[model samples]
Target chain A: MAIDPPYLLFLGDAADELAAKTARGVAHWRPDRCLGQVRLPGCKADLGLPDKTIDQGAAEGARSVVVGVANRGGVISEAWTDALERALDAGMDVAAGLHARLNDVPRLAEAAARNGRRLHDVRHPTRQFSVADGKTRPGKRLLTVGTDCSVGKMYTSLALDAELKRREVDADFRATGQTGILICGEGVSVDAVVADFISGAAEWLTPANEPDHWDVVEGQGSLFHVSFAGVSLGLLHGSQPDALVLCHEPTREHMRGLPTYGLPTLADTIARNEELARLTNPAVATVGVAVNTAAMDAGAARRYLRETEDALGLPAVDPVRDGVARLVDVLP
Target chain B: MAIDPPYLLFLGDAADELAAKTARGVAHWRPDRCLGQVRLPGCKADLGLPDKTIDQGAAEGARSVVVGVANRGGVISEAWTDALERALDAGMDVAAGLHARLNDVPRLAEAAARNGRRLHDVRHPTRQFSVADGKTRPGKRLLTVGTDCSVGKMYTSLALDAELKRREVDADFRATGQTGILICGEGVSVDAVVADFISGAAEWLTPANEPDHWDVVEGQGSLFHVSFAGVSLGLLHGSQPDALVLCHEPTREHMRGLPTYGLPTLADTIARNEELARLTNPAVATVGVAVNTAAMDAGAARRYLRETEDALGLPAVDPVRDGVARLVDVLP
Candidate 1:
């Protein structure tokens, strides 16, 4: 997909917080589309995008102002609302993945209307889904599961998809979260689905009877993340992936939203994921690890990857930097 | 709660199928509330309630017709719609726990309004729920987890609650499914909730305060049931139960809906439930077992209970026949 020339990310006050997830995603995965980033006052963190205010983005030919950060609880903050209004006022269309609708905020709604800009909610899937019947298909299925939320499941899946495609393989990417929806443009936001239909969403994305094909399904919350494990388990069961890539960030010490809970060991995570996956497909296995070493320097990242690979007995790669060739090679 | 007078249960043609779940529940849990059962033409098996045609129920002073059979996938069949119409035409209020809303079925809705009768959709929750924070609650919480769907989680929880209440203990029954909701008149339908909010639904049902009391939470699907395991895990984490009662139907040989998958052993289930629960509350433990011996003879039932008790080293009881006193004795 070619970059939609010059995108502006509205991080507002949360540029350093959860919304920064989207900012980092855009900067790293779709840098060609980025113009620059916007941050609240005193927020000096580099999001890898060009630093541009709403007006500056408009002047730089940005057609869309993407709400880059994903807020916890998906609530729209007042700061975010203000940034969105400014973007709309500057003649740019707005896109948001937050659970709260941008059209519901009156000021932003009016600004978009007056400026003739469109509103897109990436989290609201457009298609209907049916309940999964746990049927087996012909193609190979690969899933990326993480140790915690925001641990680069999407990044790993995308990298794997890209790598496989570059090798002329018949591969497809299935996005599970909103940021992934924004990146891929055509995938279900599985987390936004009703619990009864979550597996259905997975089934819809990875259809049956695709012989000799590979589907790289992006994963969601960790199997141990108390906040959203239902989505995780549903995706795990629905995907019915025979092979899995364990995505982990070595620097994170605790589970998200549960400060008292430490991360499970790599061996435990692999075992747990495999066991859960095996509930549907008994032949399920963990073939590789996708190490998120974005926080580490080059040497440290390599060491972490090597250590993870040694500890878990799987091929490991920092997919974003080193490509997913190593991980793909281990697939059945 | 006293049984309301003269209830007619609509079994339609599903008397021998999924609706049998509801039929069994009503017969075993609240038989006094039932006046008779309705089945389609050529139907012969008794659902434990006095078999009555629509006209017979009306003549017998039935004030309400309950949609007793929970069809697989919660589909409202043509026969069911016809039965509902007759019940409404007879001026009887109708109650349904199916996923399909009677209010959404045009003929049923019109019949209900025309006859000035009420339609109750039990599975649709009436209240809002936020995401669970996994905070420690003051009072003790005991959850009844099952080995499979329709394994008597609700029956076990309700029985335990009643036994505790009989003993003058401050115990409240928390319902998680449709039949439980119909019986209790309140509680979230955990499976109907959006994937991300399943945990939140659990949190809202059982609040954090109230020391010295006990909350008996009815569980939903099993942790090993691939079709609905997400809902099961969410309930487990959200309830944050200190103690659990493992509910099982020993006669079932395979996992529900999955023909190839064998049932997890009792030891494995207890260990799995405890492990998942411990993620939220380390103090969590399985205290007892609720054996659903509905499919067995009394002699065989007692022997099975004794065998399970010996193997797991937990107090075991048929909540319906034996009462839950032995189970309650093991609570923390």
Candidate 2:
């Protein structure tokens, strides 16, 4: 599903920046596609764009209204009906990554239908996917894997995509999660797909391309994570990446959410991921490391990066602090 | 959802035995659950049970009308509506693994509601599942993992459960797919679940039990199958199995449905599965090999089994021909 841009991001009564993380991601990565921001009265989050009504956003050439705030249950609040309907009436489509479907709200559904606009539920897959074929597609792919969830896989991937394009390379950032979808304006959340079609969805996200073209895929869950290794494995096999950037959070003591599980070493993580990846792309290689050093001081982060590079014998960098040029330099 | 036992099996114009394999599986594994069979006029398959009308089967104490035949596309046939309604009217629930929802058919919905009976769409999970917490539960568990798709994982699991019971071991066959669900009367179709909840559904299926109780989980796709390894890995992690039976089809040259990929060596499969399974269960062991010898002659199969045992240094048995007693003997 291609969500049209420029978007008027609606942060409806979001209590914190984390609630509006999707909007923030879009603004940071695709500022040109973001026309304005619309906030409910009690909203505490901001995307730093001009506040505008739906009519103003439409008049300013916004093509869609993105519900970028995530509530406690990822539900569209009834508080959003007026703004969503207004966006539809103003000739803009509405898109959201919510647990509740936008079409479930009769008023928004009717408004969209009346205006002949689409309602994109980014979290819910609208199309049926066949099982993965494990075919060897042309072109190159670089997938960002992690030692744990939320360890900058997306950040590393986007940075790599941007860096590759800067050097006159044909590259695309393939999103596999909600925030990444908002940033790219289109992508299926691989985690939300049916178990049988995880790899199929990934293959569809990055199809055969020009021989030198690169599809930098955002990864999900760790191979070492008991709760989500399946999603990771499926995505890995489907992505068929020639190069992988391992993302890690150095300060974390245990796996995210699962307090009892400890993180695997970067060596074990790389070795295991490469072994599993050989099923789809036998020439797959771990080219570099992307360390999420947000939890560390600059000195500590630098030390960790050095230690990781020496330990794994890969080019290591914090994609946020340093660019991904080195990582791209060793691309196969 | 518990599908009531003593079923009236419906083979609605099935063109071949393979189409009615689900019915045959139920009849074979749980013969006591079969009351009689209902075949449409052009039905080409039979379960070797007394032919009876829905009303006759209901009068004879059938608790549910099982739509056991799997038609092309897994859709509920229009021709079966008469039998379904008659069964509902006669005070019986209806269970099916069809892709089409039973409640979507107005007549079946009205009939079921009128009779206060339930309609179980076993392939589509109606209940919401949480993300897997990856907690350790008290129970002995055995999981049957395969070398590729359709390598008799469910068959081996069922055989082990039956044999365990015969040997006075407290065990339950935990079904993770549709046919097994019909055989066991209840299970979540783990592959049909949303990708994120694959492991969670598995965890829900086999919860904490008595220390001596064993949950023999039916496995899904292989660790090396590109199309479905995620489902396999999720099942492995969530199952937290102490012992794994490596199931394989001796004659298959390639992975199922994917001509591009070949099967991994049983040694690789066992090692990889054991390594990944260590994420949840560190002490997990590959206890034995379960061979699908249906494609081989008796003497050849026996020799092949002996060779496989020598190669892997594990007990190798065909669950159908030799039972799973040898596999059980090597259990952790």
Q: Judge candidate 2 against the unseen true structure and give its global Cα lDDT, from 0 to 1.
A: 0.92
lDDT of 1 by residue, A169-277 (tens): 8998887777876665457787777777887788778887467789999999988888888889989988999899999999998888888778888888999999888
> Per-residue CA lDDT of candidate 2, range A1-332, in tens?
88899999999999998999989988888898999999989999988899998888999899999988999977778898988999999999999888899999999989989999999988888899989999999999999999999999998899898899899899999999978987898898999999999999999999999999999999999988877888999999999999999999988999999999999889989999999999889899999999888888999989989988888789999988998899999998
User: Each prediction's interface RMSD?
Assistant: 1.3, 0.6
Q: Model 1, B1-332: lDDT tens per residue? A: 12244578777777455546666666666677778888887454457667788889998898777777755678888767787898889888887788789889999899988998888786775555777777777888999888888888887888888889988999888888788866664577888887888988888888876787898899988888777888889999998898988998898988887777678888999999998888888989899988889999999998999888898888999987898898878777
Clashes of 1: 5
Q: Give model 1's docking category.
A: medium
Pick by TM-score: which candidate is best? 2
What's model 1's overall lDDT?
0.81
Window of ten residues with lowest summed lDDT in model 1 chain A: A1-10
Q: Label model 2 with its docking quality class.
A: high
Span of 10 residues, lowest total lDDT, candidate 2 chain A: A71-80
lDDT of each: 0.81, 0.92
- Chain A vs. true chain A, TM-score per model, equals 0.77, 0.98
